[model samples]
Target: MFTRIQAQVLGALGVVVVLGALTLFLVPASEPAPAPVAQPAPEVVDVPEEVPFVTHQVVGTSREGRTIEVYTYGTGTRDILLVGGIHGGYEWNSVLLAYEMMDYFEAHPTAIPADVTVHIVPVLNPDGLAQVVSGEGRFTPDAVRTDVPLGTGRFNAAGVDLNRNFGCKWQPESSWRGTRVSAGTAAFSEPEAAALREYVLAHMPESVVFWHSKAGAVFASECHEGVLPETKTLMQTYADAAGYKPILTFDAYPVTGDAEGWLASIGIPAITVEFHTHESMDWAENLAGVTALLARP
Candidate 1:
């Protein structure tokens, strides 16, 4: 039924189709698709700083069972220990000053000299810190007592002025508004004082800084024995930075059993940094002083 032209066209189309199918199915497998490239593994991101090597936390449980922690920093051959708020409620600003130092060390890990280790005990009296924080996170030595239903919170839960309670030179229990208060039972009877001693013994730091309030001077680490020659150098370092005159002797009172004196007795160059009437004015100067101390050549 078909003409010669039609038959030839149909035969040619069939051959073309068969050839195309054979070429695709039998193409000798050109190199398999290049193996999918592997992207480099993603890089690790930001990491929080690690807690510095802690010599130890000399633990002193407060009358309220709260922890009074002493953190030892750095491990240089030349070491320094900074203690804050041994006076408890009487000197709340002292504790805050210590905390500021702690924050600085945490944020600026490299601020401390590589050759020296700094020990920071932020709060000497957790009991006092608790009362201070409950009201204002910051406090001062001259903070006037406003009418409060609970009365003055100037002592521990056990009603002992821990500073006065140390046995450096024990005195008869005096009254601060009818609160009998020179000192309690015996030397180092107060847990906070005891904890400080424990830390000082354990670290045996080359120098020490004990923060106090209202005194507004850097007392050379001194005692009945004498002012340390190294303490004179250390005081000058901090005093030069603060721009305030350093009072070498704190002959303000018949003070005894104070932590600084205790430290000095053992020949550790200890300084007590007393702020102006207000605690807030103390920190920036102290920061400058501390940096200068750390940066000393």
Candidate 2:
């Protein structure tokens, strides 16, 4: 019986030793070394480099050093100045409208009348435009809207009513029935106004078309002196094509130091086209009006 017990104990010890060896060898010493994965080469994305264009940017830096871009097209003696976005961010439709025109000319390239040069100051107030661009990307004609920043942005970056900052029958103070107005420190005090004035003086464009919104009719500029003869003809020409009646005078309110009036004083014909529709871009209609306006008499 004693011999049998010793023999059983020896057998158990041998089984335990074999099991311990199996566990040590079969189990992972550390984590099983992961199989090396051959990673595919990373894809190289193609990004186009900056390509310069013929369109020159004449910097009209605002008081805040915001750059206002002016683009000129065509190589002609007869120049047509197109000014838009005068109301800044609130009336982004005007800015879009102007940009649309620029796009048109860019695509067509030959749309610009050879004898007539076209100049576009697409965004007159960079600060205002920056506000609009940061919002939704679209501004429709049906939405005769503006994102007024604290209602203080109705004017330029410097709070000068650009239209009211011109030298045309300028006033010390102008009234805006909408509860916001600015006339600047003096006539053309704001850099925006000065830049435009300088460009106008330098270019001496034969006519200027200023775009606005919600009025839906075209108006010719007139001060105390009265409308110029060419102003009436210019308005008629555009209206005849656009199928809208000509509003010889704005008469909505008395405006002083108006840009149109200033242009008129310098013997340049200027017409203000105020779109009637909002929330919808009437660019098609207005383009016709402009095309007709640009058509040779």
Candidate 3:
């Protein structure tokens, strides 16, 4: 009943709808993304345990607040103290030697006798040591400066000679060779000396050894009370083993308020073991000496 033009329009519309359906059938729909997979938990790791029979402590602090450290090996009551770097950077080799001993003991814990304990003070004058070596607590040879003067870093930050700041025969001015150096305002005036004093009083070790340099000998200590009988025996034992000369006294110069002398005043047997030179540690010789001492009765 419709007109020809109306019928033609309806047929065209129907043809367009059929073409749309054919296109929908030809093109495929996109697949949904795969579901995310869960991950397994990460593995946990255990921290390494601390080394056995080896202990470290901060006995005191330097003038500039640097820690004065002590490393103790073994658990025996007969304590033997080995000190180095009392002169700071001037005797930096001593510090190196002390550290070497620590390394050795750490590696061979059984090397120390069951009845003996060894305490090592690596550097007593940390401020002076820092003036020459860059770092804190521990350092290596390369950390030291070669161009520094011989006596540049020998004194504490307060310009006092720490070796002369002890209590025995203390003077306002002390001599190192022919040159006069300040011994601090009073005995134990410097904090470094005070720290050492406190440590010694608190824990009186059976004997003490202070490593120094350029003398190539081991000298016995005395302050009014004369050298302790045991000190002479210790000097001889170390000297014989290390090939160093055992001297009764240090007369190259008059040293007042020396740490060894102060120790002698208090009846503690102590010796100053001077190395061959300021640069070399002479490890073999020192090791022999230390071994001999440890083996003693």
Candidate 4:
């Protein structure tokens, strides 16, 4: 009863139904093979390691038995020693300035020259520092007791002017701000002075810089022999860079057994960088001067 085209269509539909039935019976769904058990991807993470800038060594101890830390920056052959707080609490800003310098190097290790090694002794007289500043590392200007006699905080716990206890034209006494100060029994008499002396003798640094305050000038170091020619150049260099006056001699007061003078006596160029005030570290000027010194060929 069907036409030719209709019969062909019906026969195709019948074959498709038979195939669908065979597929359903033969395939056997099998619960989709347990959904193939999805797995988690492996994770990857990256971490950076920390880099150290300087090496610290306990070269000596203070009079109060506190550690006098010497931080060494760079391993270059030519060495320079930068000392701060030799005057202790009287020049506490010097210690802060030295710490600032250390921090700069730690932050920008590349700023240091390849051929130079810089050693910094932040506090040479911890006892004297303790006299003025109560805290260990940092203290504000208000912490200083100006009520005390001017030079009372300048001397160490043993009552000796550390700057005047070095082995150069050393005397039993020295002068500070028109007041007579004890220079210890002899040269290198105090433990602090002895420690610095031993370290200097052992290392024989090419140049030495001592930070001081309230002079507003950069003074070249000299001994009985006279100023080292290199000292004159260095003085000019720092003074020019820092916008400070370059002084050939410190005639403000007669000093004996001075640390800088001792370095000069041993043929090393030495300088004392005096800040304009005691309250501030004068960080910018000193940092400029330090950069200029390091840039020297």
The number of the candidate with the highest lDDT is 3
lDDT of 4 by residue, 1-297 (tens): 999999999999999999999977887677453567678787676665532458988888877888888998886777889999898888888988988899898888788898888899998988888888877765667777776665446788889999999988899988987789999998988999998988889899888899999889999988888998999999999999998999998898899999999998889999999999987899899889988998898
Q: How many backbone clashes does candidate 2 have?
A: 11
lDDT of 2 by residue, 82-160 (tens): 9887777655677888888888877776776767677899877766655545543334443333454433344776667
Question: Each model's RMSD to truth, in Å?
Answer: 14.3, 21.6, 20.5, 14.9
Model 1: how far is 80 from its true place, Å? 1.2
Candidate 1: list runs displaced more than 4 Å. Answer: 1-58, 135-151, 172-180
Question: What lDDT does candidate 2 reach at residue 81?
Answer: 87
- Against the reference, the lDDT scores of all candidates come to 0.71, 0.76, 0.91, 0.87
lDDT by residue (1-297, candidate 1, tens digit) is 999999999999999999999977886787565798999999998886764655556477777787777665665666778877666655666777776777677777777787788888777776765564554434444443434324244567666666666544556464444455656667677777787788678769877887776667888856667888888988999988986569788664556666677777777888877788633637678889888888765
List the candidates' TM-scores in order. 0.70, 0.74, 0.81, 0.79
Worst 10 residues of 2 by lDDT: 136-145
Candidate 4, poorest ten consecutive residues by summed lDDT: 44-53
Deviation in Å, model 1, residue 134 alpha carbon: 1.1
Off by over 4 Å in 3: 1-52
Could you give me the TM-score of model 4 versus the true structure?
0.79
User: What shift in Å separates residue 265 of candidate 4 from its native position after superposition?
Assistant: 1.0
